[model samples]
Target: MNKVKLKIGEFSQMMQVTVKTLRHYEQMGILKPCEVDQWTGYRYYKLEQMQRLGAIRRLKDIGFSLDEIRELFEEGSHEPNEAQLEEKIKACEEELKVLLKRRENLHQMIDSQRKFKSMEKFSIQSLPEIMVASHREVIKNYQAIGDMCCNVIGPEMQRLGCKCSATGYCFTIEHNKEYKPEDVDIEYCEQVEEMLKDSEIIQFKKMPAVKTALCLKHIGPYDRFYQSYTEMFKYIEEQGYKIVGDLRCVYVDGIWNQDDPEKWLSIIQVPVEK
Candidate 1:
């Protein structure tokens, strides 16, 4: 039986792979010519090399990088390690999640343009530094936040003989670095006339001022906040602003005063810098 061999160009044409790519694969040490002419320095490939090239192309199509492919076959086997393949699958799953979130944000942006074209708008404003009564707690959900304010925090301030500021400025800051549907870590702050002694439930401190804030009006239930958030983030990216401080949600009207959720209004303040 005679062994069949083809020149580099003939092999490249039959495999439908560019000569450059074949040379790159050789440089990467994942694939190499079966024979090299000593005198002429010409490369030759056997028909069996086609199987390896086909496998390499298939793996690349499925998100495997050249380095990963090389590492997989460095042990002199075409079979990939099960653990490494599992890790790749996990990475791809996380990427899919991010892509899905981006798609959802795009749809929300479109919906906001149609539904809140005139009703909601973003404003650049300054937030003044002021004395505030602060209370930090882990709440059950966002909706239950109002209960903590009306029952726990407000009453504590009154008991401590605290005088509310004339402006009645107040806002809630989320301490969470990531979004949570429940078990929310929240810090509530309300402007006051002067600093007072710290109590178990409340502490008086001076909230820092923000020179520039990207403020957006949210008119509806709190659950629909994603719509406003999508618009705000898009605006921030368009304006080339970097978020400098924590976000504050200033409650203008809610179950505390308004009977209807539709009439409730809140302001989202995001501190930013150019």
Candidate 2:
């Protein structure tokens, strides 16, 4: 009877794997050769061992860990169990998704920091309470507010021959917890030279008297608007002031059609007291 066996060098070449990799796999117990000569200390592999080596290489290509590949080989077949493979695939997918979201959040934070660095020096100014014509709507869906602003509010402001003197968008917090993006109650308002009367488009809403904040000026895209708010809050705390009322974002420019970040003028306001 003839025994078909190849030396380690020949087996490595035939299996398209480096000799060092084969030795490492042997140490890992995933790939054991047919026999090893005790006197010569030489490794020999049978031709049938080629199949398992190929399976190990394929699993490695698919990002499988050494331990996972060991488990696969311990099952004693070239094909792994379908359920186990599926579970690994799902785990890898979930990890990828989390990494992608973290990357996006980092990008947003960097953009905000850059914007704050370029802004003019902000100051604290006390603004008197003024009556503002307003309307309230229960927002079940957040998308509806954006639609109302663009489609309804934008057009209605133009129709009433009213230009925004000081416009703001605020959300009333139900509890002390941060408002979820989707569950926020958005209040959009614009200040005019004089309150309109007997007009269908303009409605009278009372704005309570309270000591509030006045920030310098911000001109940019709304995506990074939160930066201004964050800086303002930090300044407020540093000056030993406490927030007394709801926050507001006042618009100095009525034109929202401009795409340039430099042209959009907005002022972020916070109600505060000593």
CA lDDT of each prediction against the hidden true structure = 0.88, 0.67
Write candidate 2's Cα lDDT for 200-244 as tens digits: 544645566655564645656555566666777788888898988
lDDT tens readout by residue for model 1, 1-274: 8789889999999999889999999999888999999999899998678889988988887788999889878877676778878988998999999999889767766664555567649889998888999999999999888799889988889899999977678899999889999999999999999888999999889888899999999877788889889989999999999999999999988888976666677899999999
RMSD for all candidates, in order, please: 11.6, 8.8
Worst 10 residues of 1 by lDDT: 111-120
For candidate 2, the clash count comes to 0
Clashing pairs in model 1?
Answer: none
Error of 2 at 213 (Å): 1.3
